[model samples]
Target: MAFLELHGLTKTFGGVPAVDELNISVETGEFLSLLGPSGCGKTTTLNMIAGFLDPSAGNIRLNNAPLHTVKPRDRGLGVVFQSYALFPHMTVSENISFGLEILKVPQGEARRRVEDVIDLVRLAGMAHRFPAQLSGGQQQRVALARALVIEPPLLLLDEPLSNLDAKLRDDMQSELRRIQRSVGTTTIMVTHDQSEAMALSDRIAVMNQGRLEQAGSPQEVYDKPASAFVSGFLGKTNLLHGRLQRGGDGIGVIDIAAHRFRASDDQTCSPGPVKLSLRPEHIRIGKDAEDHACRVSGQIHSRVFLGDRWIYDVNCVLGTLLVYGQSGAAPFEDAETVSMSWDAAKLRIVEAGHA
Candidate 1:
């Protein structure tokens, strides 16, 4: 059995479900993320696991022990919040030792564990500083250290770095991964940020309106999204609502307005009206593409530079499409007609939802 298991985990408010029949598993020492937009039940799921909220219907098991009846303090779980939630008057060491103090651990043992986690979180020199004296990232580390000092079997973080600036958040993402790897504690985090989830999680469970849409590795979810919502949510994709039909040479052709684009026979759905998802990064403009690639024409409606890459909004018969290319590459001028190409394997069959 998985180290952490949520079976039929659900919650309701005013007779309406906030989390509905959600199921996921986290392996021993693995890092799992619940990722989705606001009010999508990610936080609620975390709260249920943390013992703050009761499930309307479902069971949460930690190492095969029922968690619903266990009090939050007795569950042997560590939690960090977006707010940091540090005691302003307490020094970093004191803050981390508070949990141990509550559990009546020996004073010497508490001090030893406090020093260990402080070093683990790279807050060695800031042990005596109060929360108010530390930077945002440092304060976050204190919160994490406090959670870890107890040596909990499971760690839960809820948007823990959301309060930091963009650069610090990025830096802390790396640090957080390092901390988790060093401890080898099973962890589950809840975040709405896609890149953060992709960077830190061993597996990501994408939620929508209280349901699990897809759960897989970062590469698997991004490259092989199972539904229309998953395709659109994970990253930038030029979703095309079109029809499909059997075509020549064992390939399936997708009919989009005046075009018939080739698709992988292995991914073709029922032969009729279907939707196609083409990532912006996959579409190439001009002749700078491999030979025999599917070539299509589009008018550059708009373009923007984003340091590392250029996003071009192209208008074609199918619809408006976005293409991502390297910043060093020459860009097509606005309203200029350009040729675009992508390999047939890049075309994906997705849900036939609204365009």
Candidate 2:
């Protein structure tokens, strides 16, 4: 049985659905991320799961026990908010011990748990300080320690690392994953940061416009998206809109202008316009296709140096295409004509409309 199950879960405001019929099942000790942009209902779903908001329809079950009627505090869940929400007057040790005290756990056990989490998050020396005196990263650790000291069955993190700087956020991502693994807790996080989700989640559920677009391992969702919104949202992707063509043995092709790109035979493509999605990194510049590769030519219109990689904007037979490649080699000047190629297996064909 699934450890956490959300079946037909939904929420609405002003008669409009913020979270439509959504069904998902998470196994024990699994780390899952609900990833999407602002107003996409990822936060709303998290809120409902945390018992902050009541669902308009459907149920949330944990270990076969329905949670829809449970109060947030009574649900036995730990939550870390984006803001950290540490009490200004409380020191790190105090903040971490508050939950235990509220539950009337023995003072000795609470102290032991607090010390363990403080070490786990690498806040050994900072526990004596208050939130106002700690760094952003340190405060984040305090929030995490507070959540974990209770040893809840499930932990929900709502953009808990979003407030930190880029480098600090990166460090915290590693720290967060380490602590979760050590404790072997089932964690569900809501995040708009794709890199964070990909780095930390065992699986990712991509949501858009109040509905689940796709759910799979990070690489699975990135390599093969279920819709245009997912392809465009999770990372950088160039979508080429085109006409559909079916060939022998159920083979499918998407034709853009005079160029035709191969589509997987397994995809159920409708008899109409289609969109072919390709990641920028998959495209090679100044290269011809190998025997099994797909080749095309384009004129470079612009290029940007990003230290680690170069991004080139090119005009091709299909449309404007973006290519990402490693930097430090000879740069392609504007207006330079270059050949681009990718493995025929790299392209993904999706239904025309965005998800």
Candidate 3:
């Protein structure tokens, strides 16, 4: 059974529908991310799940129990917002103990819970410090501890690490994953950062304009994107437009600027226009390029050094295709002739619409 479920969920603000008929099932102990761009309704969906915003339609269930009528505080949800939402006047211990105090739990019990969570979040030595005194990453950890100390059934993180610097954000991602695994809390995070979602989630629901575009494991979502939007949004992609043709060898072929390239057959296609999705890293550049696979020759228009890899823009028969080569490999210079090819198996057949 799913740990959390949303059936036909809808939310509207004035005339704009922020979330529409969004149906999703999150497995118990799974870390799921609502991944999308700004205005894509990821946060709106999180809000609905947290009971902060009532849905315009449909029901939310936890382990098959209805949650639509539950108050936000009584819904057994722990939320960590992007802003941290720590109380400025309270010390770290007080902030972490606030929820227990609101429930009128005994002071000793609240202190014990606070101490346990502070240790769990690795903030044992900083209990007496105020939020103003803690670093951004530390403050985030405190906010996380504050939520977890209550031992809620679900945890909702709304871009929780967005406030941190780049290096700190990277550290916090790994830290968050470790803490989540240790506690095994059913988690749902909302974030626009594709890398963050890919790194942390067991599965991701890609959303756009109020609808769910696709939901799958990170590799499944990245390697076999269901739509053009997912292909471009999750990571770098080379989208080549072409028409399908059946080769005499019982294989499928795509015609790109008069060049016929072999590709794996998709039986559903009926010899029509289709788009091919290729990841930048999938395209290989070699001196002795073989023509047995899908091959195209192009001139290196530009080369960019991106830390551990080199991104090359090649002007080929299929238009400008971006190829990512490892940093220390044979460097291809600008305006140099190059052969770009990838295993036909790597190409993904996609329809035209972002649908």
Model 1: colliding residue pairs: none
lDDT of 1 by residue, 149-190 (tens): 899999999999899899999999999999999999889999
TM-score of 3: 0.96
Say which prediction, candidate 2 or candidate 3, comes out ahead on TM-score.
Answer: 3
Off by over 4 Å in 2: 248-250, 287-293, 352-355
Q: After superposition, how far is residue 327 of candidate 1 from its true place, in Å?
A: 1.2
User: What are the per-residue Cα lDDT tens digits for candidate 2 across 1-355?
Assistant: 8999999999999999999999999999999999999998999999999999999999999989999899998987999999999999999999999999989999888889999999988999888898999999999989999999999999999999989999999998999999999999999999999999999999999999999999999999999898888999889999877777786756777677877767665667575777778899998887443454377888998999999999999898878999996797788889988888887667787556422
Give the candidates in order of TM-score, highest first: 3, 1, 2
How far in Å is the alpha carbon of 183 misplaced in model 2?
0.9
C-alpha local distance difference test of each model: 0.88, 0.89, 0.89
Instruction: Give the C-alpha miss distance for residue 56 in model 3, angstroms.
Output: 1.0
The runs of at least 3 residues in candidate 1 whose Cα sits more than 4 Å from the true structure, single-residue gaps closed, are 248-250, 287-293, 352-355
Error at 193, model 3, angstroms: 0.4
lDDT of 3 at 337: 91
TM-scores, all models, native as reference:
0.96, 0.95, 0.96
Q: What local lDDT score does residue 125 receive in model 1, on the 0 to 100 scale?
A: 87
